[model samples]
Target: MADPSNYTYPSPLEGYEGLEPLPDEKETEGPNAKAFINPPSKTLSKAYNQFADPITNDTRGGFDIHIYYLQTNASELKFAAELHERIRREFPELRIYRLFEGPVGPHPIAMFEVNVFTPQQFGAFVAWLVINRGPLSVLVHPNTGDDVRDHSQRATWMGQPIPLQIGFLKEMLKRKEQEGQTNGS
Candidate 1:
């Protein structure tokens, strides 16, 4: 079994036959470095903007808006619970989970998860949060099957980005992969 702590997966850029490796980090220095290369412009098509989430698909992508607060702080905990209730009442159609007192799943702090199914719902939720969220950190991430990227790279934070227990998620994925391999073998 691979040591989870020290294990490093192959780079995402690997396997390309003709692509040459970039210069060493030390070599890419100062003003005219390769690192200074201008990135390509991002252009989204009209159809892409209008694309609706698949309602029938079990893999329906949605945001997990986590409201973080210190469990030890009594006032904060009370406020969090109240806020959770408010959100639930305000957004009746959306799925609002119960407020968790401590770390649950990959989350490292006491938080509550709100599931927003459609883009309009997500927008409305965010708009409400902008004015309503007080003394609490919000970690908003989309569920897109790519767990690592969804939790880290693609996440949006209303306040500070609370460090999630991503290693736990990675380990789970690894175990699942190992199981698949063993079953196949």
Candidate 2:
């Protein structure tokens, strides 16, 4: 790819934007728990309960995707919500993990992760890339500074909060509080 902005193709099928595959790549080797990069910020860390499939492939298993992205700086929250609504309208079956809450950090400035339960939903997500962000899309990268290639890193750049991260953060806090109380007792 010469330049990301160079979306205008030459011949009939020269090059098209948004049509290319935005792969969800991850690497898991030698027990590198980094494959599960917890919420980068301590303030953002909490704990909840859920399960992630150790293997993500074409085996009737679920696919978890993390989208690393930044919004059009100072973008209004309403616009983001509207966009999400549009996505739901278009692909109602896709279960999206929202990163934003109010008009701020909730807006999913850097990353949002999603889990797909079926191949059909995965296909819908592929089609969604073209429909929502295929044109002039910047290369989305993880905060970990490594391009992950598996369900270990959810690679969907929709600028929303990952549900599992939120859960983990919440549950971690709960456990810590309980531990403190137990120690005090």
Candidate 3:
């Protein structure tokens, strides 16, 4: 029989050992060190939860919970409708948009959008969906001005990751950039 106690694990930092250590607080005395230590503070309109800050923006800080379902499946459609209704009833204060049967705007699948303002509301709503969501994929993202980053980098999934319409998003971004150029010219 093999001895379990004799088993050894590989080191986590096995490859990189040549990297220089970050300057210690005590070592930081000059202007450069001070600049590194105390970086410029971002001007935020309101204080937001640290966990949700990456996703949240200074101007329009909120979350968009998208419940995705297959439109071809009748059962899924019905369930999605019911789920939408339940969410509306439960969170009356939330700005819940109409249940879309087809891909709307940047969404790749048939989904509904739920807008939440505060971190508390977002936490509660997500928790509820985590427990109740069945046979549905959810795309939870924050409105942080940058549409590309919001959909791709800062996105969270409740179920399997359904690929977003990145092409559409990129095209829109390109158009916006062109418009800005034209306006500036």
- Which lDDT values do the candidates have, in the order given? 0.75, 0.43, 0.78
- Find the candidate with the highest lDDT and give its number: 3
lDDT of 3 by residue, 1-185 (tens): 12335445466566647756655454256656545443334664244443344455343448888999999899999999999999999999888889898987778789998888787788799999998889999988888776777787768899988888877888988998999999995
Total clashes for model 3: 0
**lDDT against true structure, model 3:** 0.78
Model 1, 1-185: lDDT tens digits are 12345434565555545755554543267777665454344774333333233121233537778899989999889989999989988898888888888988788889988877666777788889978999889988777667777777767888777888889979988998999999995
Candidate 2 stretches greater than 4 Å from native: 1-61, 66-72, 76-79, 99-112, 134-185
Off by over 4 Å in 1: 1-61, 177-185
Residue 173 error for model 1, in Å? 2.5
Off by over 4 Å in 3: 1-61, 180-185
Error of 1 at 100 (Å): 1.2
Candidate that beats the other on lDDT, 1 or 3, i.e. the better one: 3
All candidates in order of TM-score, best leading: 3, 1, 2
lDDT of 2 at 93: 62
Consecutive 10-residue window with the lowest summed lDDT within model 2: 44-53
